[model samples]
Target: MNTKKKSTSRIMLDYLFRFKFYIFLAVLASIPVSIISASPAYIVQKLLDKVLIAGNNNYLLIIVVGLPILFLLKGIFYFIQNYLMAYVGQKLIISIRYDVFSHLQKVSLSFFSKKTTGQLISRMTNDVNMVQAMVKGSMTILNDIISLICLFGYIFYLHWKLTLLVFVVLPFIGGIVRKFSKKIRRVGHDMQEKMADVTSVMHEAISGVQITRAFTMEEHEIERFHNKDRESMKAQLRGVRVQSTVLPVVEFMNTMGLAIVMFYGGQIVINGELTTGQLIGFLAGLGMTFSPIKRLTNINSVIQQSLAAADRIFSLMDEDIEEGEEDKNIEIDDLKGSVEFEDVFFSYDDKYDVIRGLDLKVRPGEIVAFVGPSGGGKSTIVSLIPRFYTPYKGEIRVDGKNINDINIKSLRKHMAIVPQDTILFTGTIKENISYGNPEATDEEIIEAAKMANAHNFISDFRKGYETQVGERGAMLSGGQKQRIAIARALLRNAKILILDEATSALDSESEALVQDALENLMEEKTTFVIAHRLSTIRKADKICVIDDGRIVQLGTHDQLMEKGGEYRQIYNAQFYFLDEASGE
Candidate 1:
């Protein structure tokens, strides 16, 4: 999440090494292409003197034939080199994208909670594309370098004096480009960050559009989006301005170099120290050299931008994953569903514990209901059962084996959880129900849906089981979403079930239907229920009253009512409210 550091060149070098063979081939191919391309300038000088100036007809024919041949070879080598370099660049992008995606999957849920989906999506999409452009687009600079070295070497062999004059401008151009690059890199980093902010805002607004409309906040949301957009635009414009200056500055130095070459070369020819052909050849090679210099100078901005994107991507990949023994598998066959918590304690942060020194036990097939005031760690207790978080101290045993030692994947396979908020992906009704068990047969899915009391409503839809659920099932009402979620859990047919305020969102009629379905599903299975409504859980086999992260009382609902403890007070409040409503 921190953007304090820039991506190192060493990392880019390492990534390039992934396709080293292709890069080497591309670089090597540039050698032949450079030699062929440089030959045309030298050939033009010879033809001007031998054919046009001297009127040598025989020599002119040979030069004409050879010129076309040289160009043909140059084109062939250029194509091969460019294509291979492009291939390598594409391969490198693919490698980085795959590693990022795989790493994200292994990251903890806490990482997701702290970051926005839009920010993460921007890193995956826009950032990766920038890196691809940098890699592929920079190959021209490499080709330019090859051509420059060849041309310069030949020019020095012909006349070192004039070459030195032309080379004098090189240091100044290098310094200017270096200065421009530093500022461009800073701007690029800022632009990428601002772009991420824009993406985050768009994602939030789109996902929460209903809430915005309900609160009449459309204007405010649009203004917030515009602000993020304006910031991103400013940063991008600054980058463009810096990049636009690079080429013109290179061209200015190149013009000065050319003027110096023509003046000095003319004097040498006038003094009879150099032939007209040699002077022309020198000037032609000088022109060729500037092309590479200009290209390399212009490529600096794009390279810096890519490095900025790489920095953001690598930072995410470098985050530490939740620590656990690798390749360890927990084996449990025919579990009896006995669960025990001994002196369990947990906290999101070390400084404050949410569940402290908790101890409880449930026998096989027992139905236990947890009742507590808000923030009493009731949901947190159920979350621990599926290893959403590990206890800071003490041990939780399932069927007499420590849960940590059990294979996390296998342990979760035997449990199903329905949270207060129901989540359904975009799919058909049948697909959503069968998601609990992807391999479930059509008959099994229908049975589970019937048990959840969702079959009737689904059958009424024109599409029936094929009915499409919009994004996150937005088309479904709150009660319908809850029923479908319960059906999903029921389809899993796990040995243990945890329902956290599952019926809280349902209307009275929907609640009765879902509660009946729940009662049926609880038969012969271990169930842990967390509910704020005392009436809904009164029929639970045992009610555990939790207060301040500890169980203050545990008994049958009638026993707790008779004892007049925390459970009694909760029951009296709910019972009186219901009685007053009915005018009893």
Candidate 2:
């Protein structure tokens, strides 16, 4: 691996520099516009010197016809310059955005755990947009610089002394621009942060609208959004205040320089030291020159703002992706579905272990149930089997082969997990059912839906299998979403299955339907069921009572009840009402 570090400017330029042909064309197109821009002054010089002073009809006619023709050419070149430069800027933004999004997809889940979705969204959208603006501004600055040089070349030829005087305020303009650039950059960063806060608040409020309305917190949420919006406004105002101040100061200095040049040049014209035409042409060129200088100074602030955004974007890109298990070359095609966790220790954060020295084993086609209090690592244990996370110590094996030795994709291909919160994408019912098996035929999708007890309700919809499930399945009820999720997993036809409280959130009728579907789905698969309701797992081949990240008791339902341990206590606590109703 090369250890050489690249500068931020170099990294950003690499993207822009890729389209050298487009940039070259833009620059070449700008040249004619720059020359044409300076031509009017020279044309007026001829009109005044040769026509008015010499009483020449030829010079007058040329001036009348030439001015419009020159402007027309300028317009054509200007259009080409603008179009090509904008094309390059937009292309650069597209490439950068693609890189950022692709990198995000490859980064480990831990990276996401450490950062909010809103922050990531802000980086991909707002930061890239700022960079886009800077790229366009850069092209404008380049064009202005070229135009300034051409204008100066003309003015110096007419009067070198007066041209020197016109640049008197250049040092002062530079100082003011440097000072203001810092303020603009500082405020730009603050504004971006405030906008990110607003994004986060919006995401939270939108995602939790149900809870907010249920708890009568609509007004509170409105106030929360308002506070974030106000902060963003304040930051924008500060940036505006800084930007607004710089332009006036720059204009004042340019005006001062223009005044000195006019006062000095007038004396020369009066003393017959210079011609009236020469003075007029020199003044015109000087004015054109200073306009670009002022804009370039302002452009410095824009560049600073873009650099701040680039810093944020590049920092995100530099994050280390999760690395483990990829080096393992073993491939598992026909897994026997026997899974074992041998003294596993794992944690989301290194500070505390959520799964500590835990061990478990399940044979092929066996149904094992995990019963634990909330946060007892039940879900984490199941997540490990699919390589969503890796244990800090010890090893997990499937069919006597270390899981880390198996290709992650191949390992996961043999397993399917139906989480408590069923996440369905915004697509047709057929798409959702075949999510796990994209190659599934229409007939197979229907079969999977039927197996999950979802066919009847789906067929009742106007569009049937093609009916759209709104974002995250918002168009469907909780029971319907869970049923679709089961249908998705069933379509996979994996050797190993995990059911994490699949029926916990459902009503009695939904639970009955889902439970029946689950029974069919788990018929020949090695199943791990994490259940909060003890009654649901009473007939499991093995019930493991987990406490404080360890399996404290392992036995069948009748054996655990007879043993009278933690399992019995949990079973009694959950079913005590049923016993009371039956007068037990």
Candidate 3:
């Protein structure tokens, strides 16, 4: 949805400014190269008119020496021009790549949530590569224009009448190219979008290959991929169709001009108004002119492609980040870990509230458990404490100060979360454990791991703490992953800890081990536990049963049992289900 329109000229000018010094050098080098390249036609004209016509053998020696020297100079200038342009192109790519990556870091989580990993990866790789191609390809356009000017000047000097005749067809060519350019730009944008789709599908299929195979959905996935591939192919062919039409039209026009020059110039020569040498020079210059003109016409496509990529890049750069006010002169040396939600209301969308008029307080070092149905907003409440999402209706306070007034960075620094779905990066065991506190020493990492009951199993591995956990800790079992996640949270030693269904994925044995670990970790921290398993929260200092985004019951386990309310209903249901299953 985030997209913008960027002009080709504007994008081209940005690149020009980005590589001004090198472009200037390239242009300067090109001027003399153009002169030297154009010099050959002039030399040939002289050889025909002066040396051969006068029957003079003396000028032969001059031609042999002068021609090679001209060629060598041209070659040297050509080398410098290419090298400088390449250097400029590479630097521009580097700068643009850095800008895109930096912008990505600043973009909010919602931006990523709406975008596919493949689409973003394609932009960073394929789209950026296209921009690079545009930058490097632009050097040819620059050289073509320079050469066209030099050749035109030579042709005009040889015979101004014919030169003028050749240019008479240019306006018509410009009109045709302009019309074709509009079509090219449309197809180019569509093509880029199609490519993004293909990348998205490819990324999804690859990442979920295991799931696909388990469900025997390989054929279905292939069909889906084929559909995307077909769309991309169609878009590419559409682009090619536009290009194919434009080039031949320009070439046909060029052919017509050449025909006119040949017919009229032949009459002039026969009438003895133009000499053979002058006519020959004019034809040679005219031939040289067509290549650059054709090249310039072809550049329309590259310009359009670069403009399309620029639009996507700028759109990402323009995303509005969640605004946070700067906090100054307010520093809490010691956080008591008390959190209070005052009439807090939140929603993914403004029109529909998820957590409305919710007020609660948790004292420091207290273990408060929130038990609820799936969509009761239990996780949402815990998320607010970390400032992941701000409440729209009311305020949340930490240590009696409005959380919005606190530095978000400083507020988050004192809290740690162990999500239901534990995430571990691709790294060694020690590295993932110490991720929450990179400054933690080796002894501290081992201590935290031991506290989570992960040290024994990690020690059993061949590399012990040095064992590399595969991507997302896939090498570890589910319980192992949870244990490492707990170790990570423990290593943070944060004043506030949140366990969001942290033990849900573990087996009974593993859950018991992790429960003991959680009990140990929750000793002094103000902890909020979100759980559906009632047994796990029995020892919680306070248990709040949430239903339909409201706290339906708040009491200790025994008190909630005595109330015979919603908590009792859920507890009885689970307890009966477990009892019946065990009897069977």
Best by lDDT: 2
Clashing pairs in 1: 330-407
Stretches > 4 Å off in candidate 3: 1-19, 37-40, 51-59, 325-333, 502-505, 575-584
CA lDDT of each prediction against the hidden true structure: 0.84, 0.85, 0.82
Per-residue lDDT of candidate 1, residues 346-422 (tens digit): 98867788898999999988888998788888988998898878888999999999998988777888998887878
Q: Flag regions of model 1 displaced more than 4 Å.
A: 1-40, 58-91, 327-329, 460-464, 502-505, 532-536, 569-584
Please identify model 2 stretches exceeding 4 Å from their true place.
1-5, 324-326, 503-505, 533-536, 578-584
The TM-scores of all predictions, comma-separated, are: 0.89, 0.93, 0.91
TM-score winner, 2 or 3: 2
Q: Is candidate 1 or candidate 3 better by TM-score?
A: 3
Candidate 1 TM-score, true structure as reference = 0.89
Judged by lDDT against the true structure, how good is candidate 1?
Answer: 0.84
Tens-place lDDT digits, model 2, residues 1-584: 11127666888778877999999998898888878876777887887889988899988987888788888989999999899988988898888888888777766677888888788788888889999889889877877877888888888888888888876678788888888888888888888888888888988899899999999999999999999999999998988888889898888888898899899999989999789988988888777776788778778778888888888888777875545555878888788899999999998888999898988889999999998677788888888888778888999999999887787778889998888889999899998888889999999999999999999999999999999999999999999998899999999999999988654467878877887887888889999999754455775888988888899999898898899989878877776676577464
lDDT of 2 at 460: 96
